[model samples]
Target: MTSAEPGAEPLALSGVLTAAEADDTARAIAGEQRADGAIPWFAGHHLDPWDHVEAAMALDTAGRHEQAAAAYDWLARHQNPDGSWYAAYAEGDATRPTDLGRESNFCAYPAVGVLHHYLATGDEAFRRRMWPVVHAAVEFTLGLQQEGGQLGWRRDPDGTPVTDALLTGSSSVYQSLRCALALADLAATPQPDWELALGRLGHAVRHHPERFLDKSRYSMDWYYPVLGGVLRGSAARARLAGGWDDFVIPDLGVRCVRTNPWVTGGESAELALALWTMGLERRAVEVLRSIGHLRAEGGLYWTGYVYADEAVWPAELTTWTAGSLLLAVAALTGDTATRAVFGGAGLPRGLEADCCA
Candidate 1:
């Protein structure tokens, strides 16, 4: 491709992460990995299963399938008997600490990671191993669902539920449920509860946001529904369009909070991924331009801005921040260079009419 007319370079880090840049970022994140295979946000913090899974997926996108699977195996080794992962694990191979115990979302996310690993390798054995985990996790998670159909955010090791459902948290559970159902379908397991759970969640997401006890000021609450395929058709299209004025800056990408001046790498990058999944390629490019200010040296990304001030409030460069950007980039461009980092897979299956019913 020729040079831009005058100022055609990518305007944001969302898209500005060149294949080489992405490679470096991916490697840097990988370097932080512990001997036990958990990837923490930075060097010192404990590793949560979700971040490990995201980083693993990033590895897949970067074409490091073996490394990615090892991450998954790390998760598999720590997999709870009830089909869940603990809320957090200490970094490295030493004795793991479970101060936070198990989290619902953490437990559910691995279903996606395992399914992706299977897609990349066509390993039925992995599928066989994960199939029961996926089912038990979904079943256990569904028990945390409230009467309003929102999911509880966490649980004690004894299976006692913690906080009420959160919009973003449940959105993820919704995604996991669909992935679980897809696995069940492939294995011919026929999970009626899985279907029922997804259907209930789709309704909560589409019809009753208030039911979710929503503290959804973040951009994650903005596009993840669409990205998760929980929203579609005219209603989905409208939600995507409606958020533009409040959350997006066509030139700068997305705001981290709906009312805040802060724009963050993780939020913007995730928004791009959501848009790309929705087939909004040009808009995804816009998000990419907004985050271009992100630096290449930091294997991590700025968490968010203080406002239009351009100063990063959260000075930390999180692994998931970079991971979100990579996943978004791969989906937006279908660029083969990034494709090798992950499997050449389509979006996970969305819930059908009676997914939860």
Candidate 2:
């Protein structure tokens, strides 16, 4: 919580974000929140459920607990009767659903946000209020899980579930399931079914590449398994090293996709968190430092910079990018709640395949 500004100096390996930078970014993100509590990608942009939760988590990191809680309340209010949300909303306007498809990963992310918020504030009432929300969302998400352990990416606008799975999305869902299970444990509600589901999900993520869509060119598909805690130990390290040269640009941050020259703030920050989770703090600090140029004067972050074109391609500031950066910094500074959420501390590991085999 040092009040240092992010200047030219190299960020300290132990504390990559200063209090000023975190506060500024948090305030900037807060500004994007609509009256209804939805945080859009930016003002006038659409809001996706997953990214909305990500930004809310960052608000918690910055000690903006009220705003963070409001964001969750927004989710609670807007949740579909079936425990899902449409893929995207028009600029936080819940009345205008831009995409009717219900994405499993997006639906499940509220659990992560709720757990993080409760951890940060130690508010049992908030946890109690959000419990049913978490339960319903997880149920909806798990309903879409294929027998192979990979989650179906989305349900069609007509409510037909897509059979295809996405590595990155399912990996994210894995983390969400873990968080949901943690919440259940805290509430003294054990979900044996979820623990069983987690095992199959983890087994699929770590062992069944054929079950998911081939998005190996995307950096998320490469790093998400590690970031989501589905991969660990030597396996996680090896997975990261395998993609290091292809996605990581020295001093420029991480590329969004392997073939793209675009280095995005969100992906870079996420990779930093992944590295931190793997106990590679030095590399994590370096990755976080590389994205410093994305920071705007107001502390919001531009979506990406295209090194090949020497331009910011998206020409937009995104709240999720800022959120990711804040979360990464939170992990680096050893913020107990943030660390516990990301590091899987005090969280159930779920059942292993052998347990049910």
Candidate 3:
């Protein structure tokens, strides 16, 4: 994604897109959005809150702000009084699965996403509308936190919330907290509970490895703290370096699950994002070159290659897959304060300390 012809505006980081490519991508995705704005995946794929948000971010990056906003509006409208979204929603021809109850994390990421949109668009009305929902979601996570300040993973309809904080899940929560506080700040709302909770969660991430339940060897657990700005400098260095061997796959790309026979486009793109965050410019560049592996039939990306690269599995090119690539590219190319944080090299003023705990 760097300049080979020298200069070229760093290629948009979501990889290069012409006005045509951007439009086509947006139109295709926008076509999937239901009248109520629950954007489905591809055509028949079910709507998922996580994937919906991810897709909306991609739409935003693609200059499809209206469509992206519509997607966010859908989330805000459907959020429960408790600040949570349905664990899973019916999508397209798909109905909600009986197996899942409302998930604790289902709402966490989208609230943060709305705030990100607010940052880019400077939409006060949107921010104001998004704040209480963000507060509720953060409040929901608080109820699930153990005395040790770690979060639970899931919630059941009729029972206690699952009490294990996943490493990546918690990392996401850590990110959502900062985003929530930022939304509160933008609206001049003083959320002392958010600040206190963010700090406790930060401390837990800083000190307790045992607090997180994800021991599976995944690239996200390795680089997310740094990628999400929860880890920095020596801590960032130590965390990423510690997980190196488990992720990289020589000339191919980063592997997905260790036991699973997969190496993926999104995972590799995310690594590029994390490396750029941690100031690994050269490594990130190499990754940018390596990412051609996961490119898809329509020039989109199939999630990953399975069976030792024999084929691409679960063959779907997702909006969030594209969204991760876009955000990673924004890190590599943009110069905002967020770029500094996501680059994992720095955090904004006073943000590094006494903030997000």
Each prediction's whole-model lDDT (CA): 0.69, 0.88, 0.66
TM-score of each: 0.85, 0.95, 0.85
Query: Which candidate comes out best when scored by TM-score?
Result: 2
lDDT for residue 137 in candidate 3, whole number 0-100: 76
lDDT of 2 by residue, 1-357 (tens): 222223312212333566666677787888888877889999999999999999999888777788889899999999999999999999988899999999999999888899999988889999999999999999999999998888999999998999899999999998899999999999999999999999999999888899999999999999999999999999999999999999999888999999989999999999999999999989998998888888888989889999998999799999999999988888887777788888986778788664321
Q: What TM-score quantifies how close candidate 3 is to the native fold? A: 0.85
Each candidate: RMSD = 6.1, 3.7, 4.9
- Where is model 2 more than 4 Å wrong at Cα? 1-16, 354-357
Off by over 4 Å in 3: 1-28, 92-100, 307-309, 335-357
How many angstroms is residue 65 displaced in model 1 relative to the true structure, after the best TM-score fit?
A: 1.0
Please give the lDDT score for candidate 3: 0.66
lDDT of 3 by residue, 1-357 (tens): 110122212324433444344444455556667777677666566666777886776555555566677788887777766776666565632245433555555557776578667655667887777777778877877788776666787777765688878777777777776766666666677777666776676777777888888666777778777766678788888877777787777656777876777777777877887788777877886776566666554446667777565887878876656566665655666634336334423222112343332
